[model samples]
Target: MIRDKSFYKFFVILVISLAFQNLLVYGVNLADNLMLGAYSEKALSGSALCNQIQFLLQMLVVGAGEGAVVLGSQYWGKKDLKPIPHIIGVTLRFGVGIAAILFVIVFVAPTQVLGILTNDQIVIAEGVKYLRIICFTYIIFTTTNILTASLRAVGIVAIGYLVSAATLCINICLNTCLIFGNFGFPELGIEGAAYATLVSRCVELLIVIFYLKYREHQLNLTLKKLLFIDTSYVKDYIRVSLPVLLNQAQWGIAQMIQTAILGHLGAAAIAANSIAVIVFQVISVAAYGAASAAGITVGKTIGENNIEKLHEIVHTLQIIFLGIGIISGTLIFLVSSPILEVYHISAEAKVLAKQFMCVLAVTTVGTAYQMACDNGIIRGGGDTSFSMKMNLISMWGIIVPLSAIAAFVIKTPPVVVFALLKSDQIYKILPVVIHLRKWNWVKKVTRAEI
Candidate 1:
């Protein structure tokens, strides 16, 4: 315990910092949801659907950043920060490329994508308008995410928190003007939300560029590095990132499948489930923040060849995540109803959300273990394959199948389907928790060229 104190301290501070970051990011969407609901219920529903599609687009950026964490943390740990800038450049380029692809898909084919989520003509029409308007912003937002993530990987936590808070304020202000046509602005309603988001993202991208050019010290991302791709570094980046990319993609696909299944049940189920998820995500960000810091800390230890200390840090982080689980879970359980009340859904949806939130509350510990092991330990050590395998098995092997069977085959309601889905966390817990005890996560993984 004494030896682990520093690790816990680091995790606690990281979690607190990241919690605010998550609040800023997710808080914007939540506030948008509430504001839209207050002004127009139909607009809120349309925006919710568009938000789901946006989440899917953002996943690619997330995958790329996660890969960067694996490489950046280990390299930074080894005291080789020279390659850090190149890594950032490479990751940002990939983010931009993916964002471009998603933009075309969402803009040129908004109806096609929106159709996949739902068949409601009203929802799809509104979603299409929102998607087409916001798709162009993805390139900017995704690029910002990679740069911001890389910055955090190298101990620049305060910047992300500060920038995100500022972004949130800017977004809200824009939302007020655009959403209600204040001060000579046109009233766009749901489209206003998309416009506000795009403006905020542009601001975020500008801030990132300013820091990267003058204020930043991590990378020297010139046009040559950004455009003239080094084949070797690109190959290695793909090689190291493949497993992580697959892991995130597969997990995302499974989640969409779950959502599809719930969609078939009806709109109320979908809305309630969605609300519960976003709220749960708010708390889960705490665990993710701990995992982020732990991954960097452990990767640095491995790069420096401090195997014993790496082992100690892993153990310490796992414990801290567990404690967070207990506290976050208890808090969610106590506040589930009040939180659900914020949504403008029907009484049935409210009750279902409460039940869903309750089940999720209990499973927070399992989530902590998986995140710490998979993100903080395995991927931190650049052991991406095992992390991929664990997630694939937990998501595909356990969660999706079981939930499908329970919900569709057994004719279960939203409550039971949610319980089945939450069971995935429990399955992921045992194997990862056991693996954490082995202390095999002490290895260096980085090319000198980086």
Candidate 2:
């Protein structure tokens, strides 16, 4: 639908950079999974459980950042730079608050928290070891994410990937030295993985700080701007960002519940689910990236008041989303066996992991399209409430209840439960399509005078 070569050029470059950055981020997790799987299944399972807590923090932090982008991009489109620093400031406040609260909860009751996920005492012990060390990174990760998100809104995305690349390399090297006790380092096992991640997060934060202080010229963001924000934007921010925050919180809790259901099944299900999830995340980075790109594009377009071209732009993006979905799903199917061979898990775990990946492969087609359509286009256009409503109805009202019953009452196989848990990805397409046709998602979230 789009005949403009420039649009394609910009979209391709942005999506690739965002996707590669996301890939590097998940690559850190892949490294941890691979190293710990080789060490022991208990260690792998523990770290994965602990990572769920981390994932919840990430969802909150990302929600705050996405809120900033939803507002900041429109300002950027209008070439209004003054409001952005304030938006970042507001976002950072929420990010730090969420991180601090999570750190406290985890630190106080590590075992109690992990216990909710699984019944294995050995897994709980290992998870405690990892959680103790990794909890320190929560605030650090949140700060880095918010800062980088501010940069991303204004089209400075390359630095994010660069920082992730540094984090990935550092994480791998440290993991190699600590996990196996190579090069005179202590063999901390799961603890070593946690330490590696902590160090990498510190390094990532440092890099972003240096870039914002020196290289970034757009906003010239400094401590003063970050600390001294315009309080007037708080109401505006809360109005637009609350739904996104709640949506993320809802989704994060749902994921933990899903994990709990499978965890109660057995250790094998937990380990297999972990492996399958990491692979799916690694493979679907491009799809997620496309969503991020869509958010920025849609938000900026709305900000510019370029309503006439919106339909063409969105249509083109949908086509691209479908293409990315097909390719990513096929790749997941093809690479499942070879990737499974790298893990040193049991035969039962490997088989379940493969089946889980196949289900993800099919659902990914829906995910790529619907995620971009809803999270990217709709939410990005300032209808954050719509996503909250959609997720509430689809995930909580339908998927979670059904999946819980299947896992608990029906006592279905793990694969069937997993498929049910993911079916929302497919069925969500109908509502998203219907919603897109109505054209009510377009709204200018920016202010007339800031």
**Where does candidate 1 clash, by residue pair?**
77-300, 85-219
Candidate 1 overall lDDT versus native: 0.74
Model 1 TM-score (2 dp): 0.92
**Model 2 CA deviation exceeding 4 Å by range:** none
lDDT of 1 by residue, 1-450 (tens): 436666657767877786778778887787687667666545665677777766765666777887777777777777787666667677877778877877777778788776776656776687677777887788888878887888777777776777777778888888888888998999888888888888888888787777777776556655565666554567657877777777777776677677767766666676677677777777777877777777777777777778767666766666777887888788778878777666666777677778888988888867776776677777777777777788777788888888879877888878898888778777777777776667565555688553
lDDT by residue (114-195, candidate 2, tens digit) is: 9999998988999999999999999999999999987889999989999999999999999999999999999999999999
The local distance difference test score of model 2 is 0.93
Note the residue pairs that clash in candidate 2: none
Q: What TM-score quantifies how close candidate 2 is to the native fold?
A: 0.99
How do the predictions measure up, each by TM-score?
0.92, 0.99
